[model samples]
Target: MKFTRTANANWKGTGMEGTGTISTQSTTLNNAQLSFKTRFAEGVGTNPEELIAAAHSGCFTMQLSFLLTEAGFIPEDLNTKAKVTLEDGTITLIQLELEGKVPGISEEQFQELAQKAKAICPISKLLNTEITLSTTLTA
Candidate 1:
């Protein structure tokens, strides 16, 4: 199976003063505003790192759910937070913190699946930076 996703960005003005809009094929983001302030100075808009974090968190959670089901365990819930660190105009690190509950699975097994999901998730594999995972498994 093959899948493709697309997003478009339109920007006007200079880097320091420029403002832009971002849109996705799914329309999850439609004309979302972005600016230098948003990326660097906590402005009132979305930024690339924030988008990356969202994508990573969603992808990792879904992958873990599939892994748990494949292992004969029913997944109750999976909550993940992905933190993207941008430094000196470079994306340096991404940390994934996951908390999950699944019936009939030990912590060791859950952690193993979490690690696998982190490694194989499409966004994780696409990123060229350090990735770390912290997982908490609950009964």
Candidate 2:
């Protein structure tokens, strides 16, 4: 199962004064110098880091839900947010937070499922960064 999405950037000049397009659709065009950069989440344009975080969070939550269902439990609600922090010009995925509710499941069981899902999820696999995280389950 090989999956892929492509984004290419063409920078005509230096770091701050360059511009690029992600994908051929021109749906996402950016110029760092002009501050015309469009955020991936806003869907107003293109930003690579936002895109990466969105992908990670989306994939992880889906994987968690499926795994929980396979474990004979269904989540009442599942919400996960992943933060990809770029600090001092170095990018690091610093934290992840998962909050959810599952009926008739022990905290231990919930944690077991969460750990399994986190470890095996495609986004988690793609990440080489260490995660400082927390998860909460209730009801």
Whole-model lDDT values for every prediction: 0.93, 0.71
Best by TM-score: 1
Give the distance in Å from residue 45's predicted Cα in candidate 2 to where it truly belongs: 4.2
lDDT of 1: 0.93
TM-score of 2: 0.74
- lDDT assessment of candidate 2: 0.71
lDDT of 2 by residue, 1-139 (tens): 7856654665455544455555433444333222134532233455666667777788888998998899899889999888888666566665778898988889888888888878888878877888655789866
Worst-scoring 10-residue span by lDDT in model 2 = 32-41
Collision pairs in model 2: none
Error of 1 at 122 (Å): 1.2
- Model 1 residue runs over 4 Å out of place are none
- Model 2 residue 91 distance off true place after TM-score fit, in angstroms: 2.1
